[model samples]
Target: MIDKILNIKELNYASSLNGDNLKQKIEDLFERPAISFFGNFTSQTEFAAYDKLSVISWYVPNFKRKSAYLKGEILKSGKGTLIKLNIRPNTMLSVASIVSVLVGIIILIAAGSSTRFLIVGSFFILVGILYYSFGIFSRNRLRTNFEKTLDLHKV
Candidate 1:
């Protein structure tokens, strides 16, 4: 039964699910082939004080042969909240960029004041910045293409 469903040309044939239901459905499909989920949570605090609030908590899944899925919740603290859309590669790239940036910062800080060490440290920082920016750009372009493909299928 699963194989037959998988072989079909159209996987997202059912359009009734949206929001939370859609999220659940995608999560349920993770056991299948060539699919994985990426989870992220972001919080914001006012004035760097004790009032910390979770702004977004969500998961995005990218499938090998199907449209990528977005599933998550947004906490409405003010005017409104937004669920992250069109984010799969973007999430991965953002993670990569963050890791690279942190490493670069640490290296540069440790190098401190020495001319030779400063040169090497600066190189690392430059490389990190390049990698981070490239990753972000690639992710955004990939996401846009994926979204276009999804829209095409819906028609």
Candidate 2:
């Protein structure tokens, strides 16, 4: 429900690689870490199966939280393969930010005549906007990375 509102990006691509080959290629891009708790801060792709691909940036320590995951599905087509991709915002993060803003607004409404409440509530809204904006920016960056790595023409 929240994901539907958080600007999901979708695209179609024409890939020459078959399902198995495409899976292998995307698998090569995933982090092969040995005894690592926190995964790569940089964006990387992983395959849940031959038909599914996930792009993630885990534990990226920064002001802008990387909160978007690129999810994709591969289908075998007559020519080669078709890739359907979606950049989805993190559900947990989105819900938390929205709830935080809502709580702030509720506080302001309850304290009808308080200027302090107004300031605090406005700050919450501002923070929520900033956080969501970073997620949007990260979405674009992830899209670019996926397109480049796949090297597929848009269909």
Q: On residues 20-135, what C-alpha lDDT tens digit does candidate 1 reach at each position?
A: 54444434443334322333333331000000111123533541221222332322323333233323222333444556667767777887787777777677677666655654
Candidate 2 wrong stretches, greater than 4 Å: 31-66
TM-score, per-candidate, Cα-based? 0.37, 0.66
Model 2 agreement with the true structure over 53-110: per-residue lDDT tens digits: 2223455554323355666777787988887777755554555667777877887787
Candidate 1 off by > 4 Å? 1-86, 90-93, 150-155
Overall local distance difference test of candidate 2: 0.61
- Give the per-residue Cα lDDT of candidate 1 at 70: 34
Q: In model 2, how large is the Cα lDDT of residue 73? A: 74
How many clashing residue pairs, candidate 1? 0
Model 2, C-alpha of 1: deviation from truth (Å):
5.7
**Which pairs in model 2 have colliding backbones?**
none
